[model samples]
Target: MNKALPVILICLLLFQCDSGKDGLPANSQLLRNTDISLSPDSFSPWVPVTNDGFSLGISQETFLSGNRSLFIENQDSLNVNAALWRQTYDGPMPSEGRRLTLRAHLKGENIELKSTGSNIYISVRMFPVEDSEGTTINRFLSSQNRFRIFGTFDWEPLAVSIPSFPKDVEFITVYLVMGPRTTGKVFFDDITLTVE
Candidate 1:
């Protein structure tokens, strides 16, 4: 009976195996709260707390999606100086020379730009974590490999891909940055990161 049990388990494991085109084990998910639900922690992975001296606001409102969508806005005493949000994933870095992709659905209204460098994007940030105690630092920033959104637009799909990264990298962070020094509202839903 024991000998037969081992064979049956092996067969089940083989039948259940699933992976992407890449030789590395597939990691299809990299973001949470994709549906933009009203759950208190829907944006937990993302820090909704305001930063610096800017009045950053994050709320749940019905618009896109079913129940609700993530709403990010900036409202200062005088004007919205800066408001930003992001989803970061930190784990074993991707393999060298592997395709990495980031995708999201976004809609904006009166997306004003207040500064020269202020811009919205779905970008990937790579940090190299040498060891358990090593401070994860930005190793490679995907400058051109990102989806940039601006101005007022309807719900649209945005996607970007990176051919590869260095082997030394040991961690990765995906960013959904709402341009700083900007006013108006931005809606987010269905965000995903995958390596293939």
Candidate 2:
């Protein structure tokens, strides 16, 4: 009976350790409330823009090798625009109590003069998909588009704080929008999200 008691106690201890409720375990590091980092070689899975005339491409001359690559497109016509690519996953995010910080490193070159305006902004959005329209209720959590120049390759890092959202958030989307009324080229790379 004494030996059996010792074995049972050990089993109970192991069970508690294996249950990850205390905090994140070694293998669970990636399962946090932050967006994955984007390197030159690694990109967050992006949903292609299906809007009329918008397109996406890969740029090599402008990215940091092995861990950085640029997503580029031409918003030359009034109807065409550029957007952040999106991807869907079944993984879990951090619980709703924590605040999320989004970060990105980007550079723009050959931006035409006519593209200057508040419409040319970079934004991050979170949306919940519903059964009715096949479209999600989009919440524009944050954005940045105020620039002083065009045609210069400016390397910039942007960070935005996202408040705790409702539990219904089904998808998070990031975008680089050229005002639907303007025309030019846009480039982006290196995005990160952290929980605080």
Candidate 3:
């Protein structure tokens, strides 16, 4: 029996090592996920906001200087009042991946609750190639539903995690959205994605 124990221990250690490679605990209930921000500069190939109905700019001098900030111009009207920043990637993500945690620093000015709501928001989503405009492969986060509030030009780090899909997803897309129907300006910097 003592000899058998050694073999069993080796098997368990191997299993744990394999699981760790995918950034998951050995007994984790969720599927494996990886943080995208681990490689900061890899988030290239972004879509810039150009619709006349909306305005967009880089949120901060530091982020703008680093060339990593995305800003939305809020055009408040009875019918139309929102701005969006979006990007898509064609590479394969861990299909069995279950959740994404979006991390970023945010700031704002004249942040009226009525104009932009009481909070700032950010989100990440995954999409399949064949899906329609309204269809989403998976929703990692939504600012309207999940966000943090700050009223000054201070750097506040925020994070939100969503579990809607399994890890088997291929072709992922991410978006950072701010505002419900407000006109206040907000800044975002150091956007990151982590999977676990």
Candidate 4:
């Protein structure tokens, strides 16, 4: 084998790992503002889900890139099962890939889960259209415990890939979840989605 083969392979690996540094790939043509970088006048595409004691918004205190990151926090005053920031896909359905992947960079402090089922993770809800009317949706997430943060931690990357999306896919809902009455502060940046 050529001496340069190893170096080229390493470069390919690094590029995949740092794909979020500049922005989503050219093929990621489905959603807008996957990263919390844009200052959307109305924040229309990304909806803030304020439920129970959890609240979400953009934060500048810490970010993986750009000037701000999406932030979520659970208030101690209330006990809730879950809260999340959600974005429903509005673009054309992806018809090429058999699987979809979602990823984001996150940092957190004191992420305490009240129940065994509680988890802090990202979820992708898929709506595949079998008829012109609509279709039932299914949700997918990264392995729960592997990426769950219960204590303070530095910036980390988490990813999930789910297979078997039909060619006639309708839409997808992406979620940044703090669940089962999870308490703590988490900031997310460079959230991205891709079909593969």
Superpose all Cα atoms of candidate 1 onto the true structure and report the RMSD in Å to 1 decimal: 6.6
Candidate 1: TM-score? 0.66
Best by TM-score: 4
Please report how far candidate 2 places residue 24 from its true position, in Å. Answer: 7.2
State in Å the error of residue 5, model 3: 14
lDDT of 1 by residue, 36-149 (tens): 563755556666535554443444554466555566665432443445556677665555567777777778977766665565666676654342455333343443224445
By lDDT, the best candidate is 4
Candidate 1 residue pairs in backbone clash:
81-181, 82-181
After superposition, the stretches of candidate 3 with alpha carbons farther than 4 Å from their true spots are 1-44, 59-68, 75-79, 95-99, 113-119, 129-140, 148-150, 163-168
Models sorted by lDDT, best on top: 4, 1, 3, 2
Q: What is the C-alpha RMSD of each candidate to the true structure, in Å?
A: 6.6, 6.9, 6.8, 10.2
Question: lDDT (CA) for every model shown?
Answer: 0.61, 0.51, 0.53, 0.71
